[model samples]
Target: MKKIFFTLVAMSAILVACEGKPSAATKTTEAEDSTVLVLFDGETFNGWRGYNKDHVPGKWTIEDGAIKINGGGAGEAQSAEGGDIIFDRKFKNFELELEWKVAKGSNSGIFYLAQEIEGKPIYISAPEYQILDNENHPDAKLGVNGNRQSASLYDMVAAVPQNSKPFGEWNTTKILVYKGTVVHYQNGEPVVEYHLWTPQWKELLDKSKFSAEKWPDAYELLINCGGENHEGYIGLQDHGDDVWFRNIKVKILD
Candidate 1:
């Protein structure tokens, strides 16, 4: 009888100790309850449009659960006509995740802090997270030290390890921006990280194609860029090749 009584008391004590504590599953549920915006619904372009335009161009389409683009031509191709697309909403600091795949020889990019000038393309003033077929694309061989390859800061900084999967295979990318610091991840590995608007960034920009004398358009657009205003649209480049993107989502950080 005493043993039974003791057991009951111990069980009661345990229950009391756990009464107010949340379980792991409950914690996960609470975490998920936080605000997250779905940029691409996998079926329609409910929250995206061409830069400075009211609608996405004919070359961009929704197919097989992916936001696909297949008409723009490669390198210096008629960009003003096929131009890039931007998220309908602008974000200052946020974490974005998406899955993307490219056809052989395809080249494209994702841009952040992207502001659309009336007649300029997104890349003119924004920093790009390069998306390219390193094995086949010629631009992959043009930038200094792999800076133009997949997951790079596009001509300004190279992603270490250059960890891009082969063409036709989907690669997951996560980009996080908070308080002027940015990071890029490829296939779950962090490959690039940098602080924006700092002296180092300024130097990199000065040496990059954005400010190069040979690239007059790029140089002019970024000539006066600064951090006084950092919030802007998220963009996908229409680089005149077939590319696929899906599962696009973002969480704006406080």
Candidate 2:
């Protein structure tokens, strides 16, 4: 009886010692730490779909653990059926990170704060983070300064001293959208930062291509319907060039 009593006491002591310990998942989601979410499983299109489509586009496929699309050929137009793939849910404020690589002469983009609207392309409503083969793509030479270069906030801000790696090499990108402040990071460095819906932002938009009379609807989408709808899809562009992406994740902020 004494041996059994000692065993019970030992078990009770062990249980008491573990009463305040945290599990692995609890360690990952501490209140002081941001809540992380994996956007891609690296195995299938579990939570992704072609922008505005009911299915993953045929041209996009899961291979070697990355989302990939094969283009027409080197320097040829993208003939693939892939248009754009977007995370199905909308996010208001988040910090997102992903890895990407583009083939030579290729172009692609990452878009956020996108509100899907009928009769419009994603670019018509969302802002893009440009992805390009700077050495070869014609667009690399056309924007005011280098605002359209890879890792730039597409057409609005230039990422100084461009840090993109060479073609076929992997690059990491981080995007943070908190309330109205937005920041873009490339290759582990912050490249561009700005606030939305401010006077300076309005001025930037007024002077950019986005302000053309041809896109009054786009202007409205960016400025008018001004609530959580600003919280919209996260998208990957199909610039008709070959591109691959993986390791996509996001952390929500309070």
Candidate 3:
């Protein structure tokens, strides 16, 4: 009886010890099961397509692990085979990260909370994170106080410090959207931040080119921003310029 009691106590203690801590495999699984979603896999266009279209435009292609947009030198007119491309999923609150590089005089943009309006351009329903060769692009000198420059809110607000690395070097970009608050990060620094569906936002829109009197359709959309559901797609603009993007990923916050 004494031997059996000691054996049972030893077994109980072992079981309790095992239950107190997780195994190595459990720890590894928890570490590996991340919430981040890769928007591009470097080889395939699995979750992307042209905005308002069923297929990716031919001007956009994967080159050397980056999404490269072949330029047509037509500015915003875009190429005959080019259009904006977006991920097929809609996210309400997320943190999107990517790296981009542009050729001399190139221009592009990253759009968030975008809606697909038939025959309407992506900028009509989305806010853009301006990407440009600030040193060579004419738009860098345009807008009110350099708002059209790289890392700006594409004319609504200017990115202070204007830390774009010229044209050829890669720059890391991050866009965080959570509960009506949006922030744009460039090269690991916070550049622009704004809130949606607020009086200040309305005031900003009213003062900008998308005002109710100037562009009523865009004003209506920008006023609401994310629509009834407050969810929208992520998009990359093909502004008829040579641009490259890679390491695109997003982490859902909602």
Best candidate according to lDDT: 3
lDDT of 3 by residue, 1-254 (tens): 34334544654355336543434445434235465789999999999999988999898999999999888866543544788999999889889999999999999999999998888889988999999999998999998999999999988989876899978899999988877777788998777877789898998899899999999999989899989998899999988889999999997655
Segments in model 3 whose C-alpha atoms lie over 4 Å from true places: 1-31, 75-80
Badly placed stretches (over 4 Å) of model 1 are 1-34, 75-81, 212-227
**Per-candidate clashes, comma-separated:** 2, 1, 0
Give the candidate number with the greatest TM-score: 3
Tens digit of per-residue lDDT, candidate 2, span 48-81: 9877788888878887889887665433323335
RMSD of model 2 against the true structure:
12.8
Error of 3 at 244 (Å): 0.2
2 versus 3: better TM-score goes to: 3
| Error at 189, model 3, angstroms | 0.6
Predicted candidate 1: what Cα RMSD to the true structure?
Answer: 11.5
lDDT of 2 at 171: 97
